[model samples]
Target: MVRILQGLAHKYFSDEEAIILLLLLVVGTGFIIFFGAMLAPAIASVIIAFILQGLVAKLRSLGVPEIVAILGVFLVFMGILVGFIFGLLPLIWTQVSALASEAPRIIRELQSYLELLPDQYPHLVSAEAVNTVYQQVSAEVGQITQWLVSFSLSSIPDLVALLIYVVLVPILVFFFLKDRRVLISSIGRLLPPQRPMMARIWHEVNLQCANYVRGKAVEILIVGSVTYVAFKLLGMPYAALLAMLVGLSVVIPYIGAAVVTIPVAVIGLFAFGWGTHFIWVMVAYGIIQALDGNVLVPILFSEVNNLHPVAIIVAVLFFGGIWGMWGVFFAIPLATMLKAVFAAWPVKTLERSPASEEE
Candidate 1:
């Protein structure tokens, strides 16, 4: 086995030049991936600042003090956020409370459905087994609150990190917005002479992140509103909460829509007595999503990218596997950047353009 491995390694290195070239390419790709992940926070911050930086710069250019401009922008943004929270919180709270009260009934309905299945096929499952499972679930119910508290405690560090980000981002954002030219020039100085091309590529990638901020906010609100209204009309419990979840998840792209709908459909099944009515609600969700994907998103994010759906799926899974939920959240934007970069590459451009046009 060792001899065989040695022979393969020898052959691989026999062409030393090719081996070095391959290694360099591998290292370069790894560096780009690593750099992307590492700079996610700063990238997010910069994009956010860019949205308001134009206004800030305009104000300063027009004789407004930097402090006043910053304050005005911050206050305007905060007012928008506050208004949204104030409008949505009550409905969300009410639905969440209603869902908590209905949990036992939902569980009971599930138990009944399972028991009925066994009755329809006695050899498949016994009454004793069903009862045992129900009893086990009932026992676990008492531990739910304890588990939640423990989970919260375990996530203290993450909570702290989030708090740190909350505090730091605004400060970082202000400086970035105020001194954007200086910062960009400083970064350019750090790169090698030949790598100005790479720096420009990075800058272009940064510019594209605004697509996520602007596009996602609109998409999430629309999807969430549709979900809330759909659930409420269906008389599903926790309509507001479910809608919020569906809306939040919608930002994650393809899989998010399904994840948001399934539980709501299940709850609707129990609430509406398991019939065509329940099925109709699920079908409505599908229709709404289809419209959103085919009409709403395209209209809203027309220039976002035209990458294939399969590529989006691969990105979500590939990155999500590496970094968990955050990976999934960033996947689409990252994928969009990849699509834009490749499409804009010199070779692709030259191929598409006529020789006279290029010259």
Candidate 2:
């Protein structure tokens, strides 16, 4: 066991740089795990600044002054932020409240539909099974209601934190953008000058993560806006709310679309019943999803390395378990970072003895 352990350690961590990198990763992950909540605003600012850095670089490439480019990108970000806060947020909130008010009616309709299932499919579904299912759903809904009430009652502190983020994030993002080089240089100064392995991993991780984060942001906006327009055209209820769900559903890769389909289908059924209109609404949604998967994704993420569906799902589950929504959101990026690290990691190959080589 001792020899085996030593062999494994020598094989994987023989390089001093590898040991240093491992320690850095451990320390960084520990910091985030311990202080993530308190430093959320700063973390958010970093992500936003990272996303906006591409635009800043593009403008700089076109001979725009760095300060001007930063200001331009910053202003555009603020406009979008303000629009979302004032316009889109209220619309979504109103729809959410409206949906909540109509929930009992929807539930009743659902219960009535389920009650007929046993009769329609007597062999497949029993009355007892239907009753059990309804009970489970009702219990879940009740729990959700309780949770919402508690959350609302406790939301004052959250709102205060949100206000602080709104004020501080922009300021932090501006400085981050303005002092991007200075910050990088300062941090770089702390590390050993000879860090080829670290440099390679950072380069790959930075490129992949930046592309993913920015592309994902664009995808969500496009998918949500297109979904909203399509739902509105189909005269679907809760267009904004449904669109938001549809947009966010993309975050979970293969599972998000499948999960969100239930709500969209349910809402469409309630609004249009089992008819051509409902069919059309579903068809439109299917088309949007198809286009997003086949067209938009390829275009936006042309430079990204595509993970297998299973790997993506596993990453989502693992990271989301660790950091909740943030983990879910950055699962792909984090996974990519891990992939790059593994690819670049230094490993000393075991040397064969003369007897083994002769054999």
Candidate 3:
């Protein structure tokens, strides 16, 4: 046991730099676990700043002054933030309330239809089974109602926090972008200068993460914009809202598209009665999804490497479980970081064989 422990230590924990890297990782993990919710805005701002850093760099490369470039990027960021807050959010919120108010009527109509199922398919579905399913459905609806009531009542505190975030995040982002060099230097000073493994990991993560994040932002915008145009042309209700949902669904590989499809299809069926409009809407949506998965993603990630499908799913489930939307948003990068660390960690093989020894 002592020999095994020593061997493992020699392989993985031989250097002060390795110990420092591990300690930093542990501390960062602890910080997230302890203060994730409270510090969500700050963390979000940092990520936004990270994404916009590329834009800033590009502007600088065009011979724009650093301060001017930062200001320009920051203004664009603020414009989008304001547009979301004052325009899109309110529209989405209005539609959400409408959906909520109409939910009971929809449920009643669905129940009435379901109640006729046993009559239409007596051999397949017994009356007793229909009754049991009806009861379960009703109970689930009641649970959803209770949750909605609680959510609406509890949203006051959340609104206040959101307002605080609105005030704080821009300031943090401005400073982060403006003083990026100083911040990077300060962080670099804490690490050992000669740490090759840590430096390699940082470089790889920075390059890949930056590309991935910027590409994702572009994907979401393009997908959402195209979807909105399609839905609007089809005269669908809540076009902006559904388009946004469709856009964001790309974050989770397989599950998001599947989960969100139900609502889109239901809404279309309810509105257009499975007619040509409904068929057209669905077909267009399918095309959009296909293009995104096959075309946009491949082109965007062509420079960046692909993550394993299983790794992505596991990361989405694990981190999304922990941090909700934020976890899901950052899951790929987090998984990549782990992949890099594990790949670079020192390991040795003991491959001495009896046949080889004899030879």
Q: What does candidate 3's lDDT look like per residue over 6-120, in tens digits?
A: 8788777886777888899999999998998889888989999999999999999999999999999999999999999999999987887677777777677767767888889
Stronger candidate by TM-score (2 vs 3):
2
Q: Candidate 2 clashing pairs?
A: none
Query: Candidate 1: global Cα-lDDT?
Result: 0.71
What shift in Å separates residue 79 of candidate 3 from its native position after superposition? 0.4
lDDT of 2 at 261: 100
**Candidate 3, residue 235: how far the Cα is off, in Å:** 1.4
Winner by lDDT between candidate 3 and candidate 2: 2
| lDDT for residue 341 in candidate 2, whole number 0-100 | 85
TM-score of every model? 0.67, 0.96, 0.90
Clashing pairs in 3: none
Please write out the lDDT profile of model 2 over residues 45-127, one tens digit for every residue.
99999999999999999999999999999999999999999999989988977777777788889999999999899999999
Q: Backbone collision count in every prediction?
A: 0, 0, 0
Cα RMSD to native, each candidate? 8.2, 1.5, 2.7
Candidate 1: pairs in clash: none
Query: lDDT for every model?
Result: 0.71, 0.92, 0.86
Which rank order by TM-score, best down to worst?
2, 3, 1
> lDDT order of candidates, best first?
2, 3, 1
Stretches of model 3 off by over 4 angstroms after superposition: 116-153, 348-359
- Quote the positional error of residue 42 for candidate 2 in Å: 0.5
